[model samples]
Target: MEFIYTNPIGLTDLEVLEVGTQACTPTMKFGPGVRDMYILHYIHSGHGTYSAKGSSVSVVPGGLFLVVPDTVHSYWADPDEPWHYTWFGFVGTMAARLCKQAGFTGSPPVRNPDPSVPVDPLFSEVLSLREEPAKELLLTGLLYRILGTLTVPDDIPPLQPDVGLHVRRAVSFINARYADPIALADIAAHVGLDPKYVCRLFQQRLSMSPYRYLTDVRMRKACRLLRSQLPGIAEIARSVGYADPLLFSRMFKRTIGLSPSAYREKAKLENTPSGT
Candidate 1:
């Protein structure tokens, strides 16, 4: 069956498509499509069979399935059962690399609800966003959270030189100095490694390049600044380590699809008291 609706959230790098219905009376078919960086499906209700890479798996309520991009996959619900599911498809350079680092390699899909562990709350949130904007952001956040949960399993074997420690240090440094003009070299220097090696380690641990991750941090900070009434455009840019207001505005618009002024204005309007 053709997808009746698709909602994309965030920037081009990351997107979430929430699918509604699940029953396929006649066998449904999907041609080869790009394997997204990440495809996360939360089965809200009903049952279905999803096939990918010549392997098929039965899906049920509370089931969570993740498929990496470029893998051929399709699904059909039992005519009688009719599956109701919410699927989030996201592709980002970092997201893709992270999936691999998390050991979600190859075409075989990863099933979360394996008849043993309890379903995670993240699953519920993904299924709840059926509408627009909220659906999109929620799905994006869910994918991020899912990746976080999956990548750092408790039982994973230890890494040589304790890669996690270097990653953790890098993350800490970024968080503390995000407002500063930080670079990958600085992060690598903090961990006493060459920049190239640090980049590889970050990709292995975080599934994204340090530059993108730094940008993400700055953008998140920029959003907070937009919501606040104090910071001017130039000040906000400086706060996020961009010295040029025009350059910052361009990056902001590219990442957020709205000029900083417009974003702040909308945010103000939404928060303003009705009587005032």
Candidate 2:
């Protein structure tokens, strides 16, 4: 077995985090260990079985497995032929986001539908850049290229037989996180999609971008909360993920055509007993 490790600094420290590759034997088995970063394995030859999330899958040539962070996973090479695979370990903000965008979130092995795809050469390129002075910069971009080959556009009917499934996942993620300060990237990661693609899916299905949908949802809830006269403007804004009440008021005006305070007053007056 051979392992190559590299220190993370410069471009890597900021964008990539850390990376390495390994070739192991059938006897080589790793724990039920947990990782704080993302790891992708591309099998060069032979076979292996990866067990995770209470399921096991066989992987062969032209196959890849994505191990997301904070999860316990284990794998072992085939007893007879063993397995030779390359692992590209990564972290940092872009690392997990890119992996999720490529449809790799606690799923099965990714098989290159087209066998002709040069899986070996691509991984070789990842190792070849190890000794260079610009290793981090080069490797960061190289990883992106490698992952690009594994992903398909969201619109492909064969790949996405049920667009509604993805849309529901997006909605679930939003409804779960709307109260917290969140970004489109985080939301996309939750659904294993690129933000742009998620936005496109939203626009096609709901006729609005993800941003607009989130804003609309927040404003509607805000209206109900204001009508209740329970939470103050600043408190309500914070509850909806805005740190600044002034900013939230501006957004409310833009969406509802009335300031938060004015909306609350009007709603309360309209609710008063008709004779009073």
Clashes per candidate, residues 3 or more apart or on different chains: 6, 0
Model 1 over residues 33-65: C-alpha lDDT tens digits?
A: 434336666676777777778877787887766
Clash pairs (backbone) in predicted model 2:
none
Model 1 TM-score relative to the real fold = 0.50
What Cα-based lDDT does every candidate model obtain? 0.66, 0.70
The Cα error of candidate 1 at residue 89, in Å, is 13
Among the numbered candidates, top TM-score falls to 2
Give the residue spans of candidate 2 off by over 4 A. 10-14, 155-276
